[model samples]
Target: PSDFSGFTVDGFKDEFEKLVETDSKSIVLDLSKTEFIDSSGIGAIVFLYKRIEKKNHKLMLLNVTGQPYKLMTLLRVDKTIPFVDSI
Candidate 1:
């Protein structure tokens, strides 16, 4: 969604959960369109990461830029979760 803030995090969480059922070895969350993200959004990403990790699946953040990128970098989350510029 456009706004990956607290308002959209619940939906993101629900949708992300469904992705776990897919057979794909890697799950990528494209943040190119996300203009805004709050703590709730970050929490959702962390939660998703843990879920994917437990399943031995990989989670990648794609096109993360602007404030979201800065925040994740600042928190050192980017160190744990891989960020990809392309597929």
Candidate 2:
């Protein structure tokens, strides 16, 4: 997903909710190609992370770099959700 901002967060939330409802054990968000992320996007991801945890599931961010990485670090999201360079 690219430009993970307010305009795109709702759709992402809905789709992610579906996956959670279907008992997804883990979710890997691939941010390699994502160029940007706003506060709304961060909130959405955090919300999803909490939801997954409620079901004993995990959420991982993959290939985060540039703006997204910096934002995540600034927000201390990396402290909560684990991230990796690849799947």
Among these predictions, the greatest lDDT belongs to 2
Q: For model 2, how does the per-residue alpha-carbon lDDT over 7-80 read when each residue is reduced to its tens digit? A: 98877767877867866687898888999999999999899889889999899999999999999999999999
Candidate whose TM-score is highest: 1
Minimum summed lDDT over a 10-residue window in model 1 is located at: 5-14
lDDT values for all models: 0.87, 0.89
- Which pairs of residues collide in model 2? none
CA RMSD of each candidate after superposition: 1.0, 1.1
Local accuracy of candidate 1 as per-residue lDDT tens digits, 1-87: 778888778766568879877778999999998778888998889988898888899999999999888888999889999999999
State model 2's lDDT: 0.89
- Model 2 TM-score is 0.92
